[model samples]
Target: MAVYTKRDFSVNLKSHGGILILALIAVFHLWIQVTGLQYTTAAKTGWIIGMTPVFMALLGLAVFKESLTLIKTSGILVAFFGLILLISHGDLSSIDLISNKGDFLILGSSFTWAVYSIVNKKISLNYPPMMTILFLFLMMGIIISPFTINDASIQSVIHLTFKGWIAILFLGILCSGAAYVMWAQALKEMESTKVGAFLYFEPFVTVIAARIVLNERITLLMILAGIIITLGVVLVNVNLKKIVLYKKSKKDM
Candidate 1:
């Protein structure tokens, strides 16, 4: 691409091959999310997806030998509880009321996403983040196109309204393309475990977006759920030793 498109590069084919493997894992994560959504409620899916950070923290320890401190572990557990609150809408009974194949699939997707993040971080150590993401987007687009490329879809694209086309362009360009590139860049700079905490906020973001776009009401439970989720994420990122020492000192008082 650098040769024909007038771009610059020093990366070799072997390096690109490594990026491609990482991209494929990312593609698999995306595929799983889509497939899982079909079998579950969006709320359930979002809740399950929120578990990715926890899974990423664990995978970072298991796969990359990343540091797993007491604080980080506690943070993960706290984040998890917060996730439960968000998912269950603060009703303990609601969790048991909702369990199905889709929930399981979403869990699988979370696992895969963690894997993808850890692997991407590993690979980014060698390659440029932007270039790697570009390659990933290109490859994933090619792989995914076949699934959507049918006679009915072909006809539908031509009939899409101006607003629909704009939305598609925005998603393809800003969300999928730019957002992915930025995420890749972020993963390159941070520990995958630390980065995973960001997933906890996703449901909250979804809720806010829903309120604006879908005109959904934000109840007290939703606000509490958001607070718990944020607290959990904060705990996951907080220094465990500091927290312990602080508690001990206050007890001495």
Candidate 2:
């Protein structure tokens, strides 16, 4: 990104501090997510990870003093309900986080992601979006090198198949790199709650991908839940005033 932009990689001390903080949060968020997945089922993990929007809303309210309007609250509740329905497959009783140690870890990860989003919104405008992300990636890499550079890890990477290497590249370059840069840019222009609400689509997308890639069956219930999730996301992001004005203008015309 830096090379492509041709902009010098220089920042003030304050910007450097922001990048460091974001990097630390990213490291913790990634670590917790990976660790949590080991202790819980994918369904449970998805459901918990879906709570990120709620955490983002609450944290925005508490920390950033961002307004929590009625529409936003309703959308969050609606989306959260859809998430529960999707994950539980209509059996709410099966969704249990109390018994799983990993659930807490995943929950922590969700909260940390909220923190990252909120903090990034405040700090990201200080630099070019890609530059900020690049600096953050570098900082996180430095922080994580000690833990990941050992002989066992090196040998594991060496032993990975072509498919494994491809997966790693996809995750590193597209998922973490490109996706985060876009996310930061979104934060620059949108409210944290609105941006976070889009995360509700993660599991919905996962289900669709699984259907296509893994040839998994998609039930009617899943379709309904996906529609509900989409509606909720739209509800959270739609501007009621603009809609009302548009309607009035059309009537006048």
Candidate 3:
């Protein structure tokens, strides 16, 4: 995490392979709006698909002898249950075909994110974590340039009001550019499982941002879902060994 503040360009060399993977993630994020528009809202399907990483990790444990402690297993199950609860009300069956398309986009996004996480770990081995992330964001921005056109979706850019320009600036500079850098840096020093834990914070941030910007309602269900999702995130990232040790100490006392 200190890599975020470290100014060691010589330490962090960018790889073409990693750049390509990060670019794919940026493109996926750019297109994710299509999923929201089609689905009419972000729903459980995305969360359901997103939770596959836990299962994949489990399978790796079973097949490749990865460690599988009780706490970790419990965390995964809790997160899965929370995700199910998060989107329990929606029925994806009504629009099966388009629903699949939306699901595909979100799943693709998750895969890219996972790939980025893996690549960050590799790149950070030799380079400064911050530099690795900066380059990744630059590559991602370049890759997504075609999609961020000043056309229909970018009408605000064309007939720019002050607020529109501000929104654009916030999204481009602060949210997309800066946040990507932070994420990349985080991925560098942390295990993918640890950094990927931040994803549960995503829905909360989106909902809060939406409420503030779009003037959307802060529903009772949304609040409950956010809390549950947060709990899931906590479970996923909790140090199982530490928890066990602490409990053991308490029992000894």
Best model number under lDDT: 2
* Count of clashes, each model: 1, 0, 3
What is the TM-score of each predicted model, taking all chains together?
0.77, 0.82, 0.68
Ranking by lDDT: 2, 1, 3
Q: Report the C-alpha lDDT of model 2 over 1-253, residue by residue, as the tens digit.
A: 6688797777767798998999999999999999997876554555566677777877888988977778877877887787668666789887677555686788799889989998899887777777889889999999999999999998999899999999999999899999999999999988887798678677666666666776667678866776675566556655687789999999999
Better of 1 and 3 by lDDT: 1
Q: 40-87, model 3: which lDDT tens digit per residue?
A: 445433344345346434544554465766766777777655654555
C-alpha positional error of residue 85 in candidate 2 after TM-score superposition, expressed in Å = 4.7
> Which RMSD values do the candidates have, in order?
4.8, 3.1, 4.9
Per-residue C-alpha lDDT of model 1 across residues 132-194, encoded as one tens digit per residue: 776777777777788889999999999999999999999887877778777888998887766
Candidate closer to the true structure by TM-score (higher is better), 1 or 2: 2
Candidate order (TM-score): 2, 1, 3
Off by over 4 Å in 1: 1-6, 9-11, 35-48, 88-105, 198-201, 240-253
